[model samples]
Target: MGPNVHIWRHSRCRGAGWALTSPRARSQAVPGTPRHPLVLTETAAVSLLNCLFLPRVAEAASLPSALPLSASWKELVAMWLPAGKASGRLMKNSSTSPLAEKQGQTSMEASSQSVQATSGYPSTSTSTSTECKPQVLPVIIPILLSILFVACLVLNSTSLWIFWFHIKRWNSSLILQFNLVLMDTLLIPIVPLMVTYFSLGNSWLFGQFLCQLKIFILSTHLYGSIYFLTLISIHRYLAVAHYSTRTLWKKKSFLKKLSLFVWFVLCIQGLPLFFVLKTSVLNGTVKCLSIHQSEFSSVYLYYSIFLVTISFLLPFGISLICYALLGAIIMKMSSTSLRGRVMKTKSLQLIMVSLAIFIICFVPLHVSRTVGVIVKYYNMSCKLLLQVEIAYYASWVFTLVNCCLNPLIYNFSSEKFNESFSKSLRKFRFFK
Candidate 1:
């Protein structure tokens, strides 16, 4: 018999109310007992017994299952002895220990917290965030740009050639029309680049310098077109409203100086685009004119707003006022001589054509651009930002339609344009 058997039997006897001697007395009489005939010292026996049963006691206590009788005996003995202090608690009476239950509850709470964290909010990481991309107008934009580029190149080139070679008398309206055609011709070269950009999903393959140049040139074209249109409107207004006054509208030198002044103002206004417009890599792709919200965003925002006001809104207002006054004067002249009425009728037709071109080509673009600037600098929600991006690009492409449409407007509205175009086409054998 060993000390483990003695400990077991001693626990059984204690449960049965048997009186046990002290460990010292038990060691002195252990060799004389019937069950334990071995002569082991008290300290050595306790050491051996602890080495044998302490690990089992700890394993049984840490688990959620109920302890066996032998483990429970070891645990109760360990509770009264100081040597078993290092061993952890045991599940003696219940099926599960308090520590084990608490651990399980904590694990469940952690799992639920992880789930809530994932499902509660939108991800703010750049990799997972939603970004606004340009809308793909599959057939409309590419086709329109293609046709417009060809027509604008041919018509504007022909107009410039005729203005230089054939049309010698440069009236105020003729000079303004020449400037308009010049602006349109300058803008026509950018259309192929734009077509490639949009066709490639708005990815700009050109270098950063070209990107900045493209934006600068486009901005100049937009305001230049508007300024010339406004000048044309004012000329028509003067021709109708103040027919007797001999002002600068009849002087070739004054008209030339005015054109130069308009160009200077537009160039000054567009100087910021050369500095502010830039290309950056977004989502592993190069994007042009992509202004992000930054410390300078407000500065760019206010500048952009001012540009739109001066270039687009102001010209639009001036054109409207001029046309309105011209219309009233023409109406009053309806009861005058038949020749005067016929001339007023032709003027009204031309005014209507100019207004239609302005509204159709520029209005949607400026409105969408204004909204986009607001949404961009202010950091609006993703959905509205996406919508504004689509509208802005679509209207941008629509505005380019004006480059080609202006020649048509001039052909129909001006008798000189018609005569010049006809003579040029016949000279080039386009019409026999």
Candidate 2:
């Protein structure tokens, strides 16, 4: 039953008074026995084999001779031996034989290990590395990002078309919104790369130079976005708060120059990024940390404060104030004096709605991440895993939302935006 083993046995036949049956092959066959290889009756063969090979049977009978030898020993041995040997021959050593099994196991384990070691996410890999299969974001993140990227391109393309063709280019509000659309369009493509990188848990899948290039792009876009947003808010403030002010901050030429200055300043502000980001291994995964080491924490903090204040908080505050004031002024305007004044007021209301959405989407993420990063520096603990996970997922959703919201924001919130967009559509349809 276990494995094939060779068995050697002998048997004798004895008859008495023509009885053809005898208990001992003359067990008493000559009391002084020559130790012939033990003769076995069929029963004795099975029993002897079991006793020598099977401890249970052997333990039952202390003496081998104690086996009850049948009168027909020859027939019994003939019946069982061949069958048992054939069964042994047919037995699968692969499953039961220890040496054979161990070898097979070794082969299987090796195959599995090699498979796991091979390049992971065949969806992403140029070549297979089956031996070291670890779950990586490089394989998955790009996919999600690519999907969003395409969507952003399509949506923002519509906005861009409107900005280029339909916008009057004279109305300061229209000019302002057109610039905002242009800035947002420029910002969309960078997301896929960031998504790929973040998907790898902040690991920079792109090489060192590309890594720095990406960070530069990211910082520039961030600063640029804040710059344009602040400009949009300032434009609204001039139009609504200082209604009929002597100077036109809304003038197309001034707005163009302002946009150029914003780009220049953004490039300058993002330059220091080259010094901070470097490739490093985090928990055995390669990542781009803010610095080569914590020695630069102070510097990173200083930059972060500047960015959060000047780029995020200040722009957000200014936008809120501008919109709030516009809403108040629109309410105070003479409904009888102006045609469609209420509709124009509704545009300001739309801008307010868009501003609220932006705050709702991004503010929580910045707050939690800032807290966790600061707390982690002083006391790293498992308790923060929940907060980190929340911030991470929230940031992703927030970013994805930004991709599609620009056009809708203009269309729904700002009537001036809708007017610009509709005019562009009309020109394309009629002229082409």
Candidate 3:
């Protein structure tokens, strides 16, 4: 508008889309600067150049009068943003930025003030846990998991002792339930330390081989828990449902053969993890882990989940149905006394506890962990440690709950467990 404010758009070179901020840089102008990219008069383009991308080395480094933001954005525009074919970045920025330019000066000042506000005021609220203490977590979470894990193991061990020595001298039928307890006693010790490693943000201070071994053992034990519970359900169903039928021990060697088979498969099942799971460093923190590393890993976590349902959950559900069916059969066959009713009711109650534990301690963990694995394998950027921490921390509690709950499962399922446990107490009482 003013005579001295010359809005003259000049050419840097005829074909070049150079938008120089400095008047001296464009002092040697070509015939006519292509003005469409800037969408601005020379004066407005100069104003934007003055306002934003200049100050930092504008004096020292002479750039093209106009350059695109990146080689990629330029390529993208050329390939797609049709306007770039006719004009260039300066024109596009100038045309789009008039209202923005007016507000930008105000907003940029406000932004700088906000940053300074944080520096000056300092947060007065002590209740806010804004401070990050990743280092402290490794040292602390282990101690807590260790205490809880030990408590769980102690319960499982007591359950095992009752099953092993105190329970009535039945055949291997009762021992099926006890195996759950035995596995928990054997399996749970590795967890507190692993939880500590996980709490430390997945960094494995443990060596490479230990990392693989830990993952293999953890996976094996977790799956073993699932298998044993399923076995107990089937064992109990067979006993009560087919009371008139042949005993499990008397026919087909089902007791010994089946026990050997389940463990044999579980041992083989763990072998894949031995090769795949490893210590990984991400964002400078080490994590002992696996997220479908191979085609195998993807196949394993998901397909196995489906397989777990088909082989374990669905079968267990069938066992529950059979238990209910058998209870009805018992009610019809003999309504003689309260003792008969009490025994059948107790058997049903035991199976209910078994089902409850799986739903309570396992289902949530599987759902959350599967979601995490999907996001991770797809390489989405949102793997924030805080999110990872929350997800994994919740998962461990459930998963470890699963690891430790088997003893109660055994006690609930077997009647021999009650008589034998009482006898053991009597023997110990006499010794004292």
Q: Pick the candidate with the highest lDDT.
A: 1
**On residues 349-372, what C-alpha lDDT tens digit does candidate 2 reach at each position?**
567655864676557656665665
Relative to the unseen true structure, what is the C-alpha lDDT of residue 411 in candidate 3, on a scale of 0 to 100?
A: 54
lDDT of 1 by residue, 6-82 (tens): 44445442332111234453455645566332334434344434434554454554422222333444564545354
What is the number of backbone collisions in each predicted candidate, taken in the order shown?
0, 20, 17
Q: Pick the candidate with the highest TM-score.
A: 1
Better of 1 and 2 by TM-score: 1
Where is the poorest 10-residue window by lDDT in model 3?
1-10
Q: How well does candidate 1 score on lDDT at residue 417?
A: 75
Per-candidate TM equals 0.67, 0.58, 0.61
Better of 1 and 3 by lDDT: 1
What TM-score does candidate 3 reach? 0.61
Task: Give the clashing pairs for model 1.
Answer: none
What does candidate 3's lDDT look like per residue over 274-332, in tens digits? Answer: 77566665556665663423334575567556645664567557656766775676667
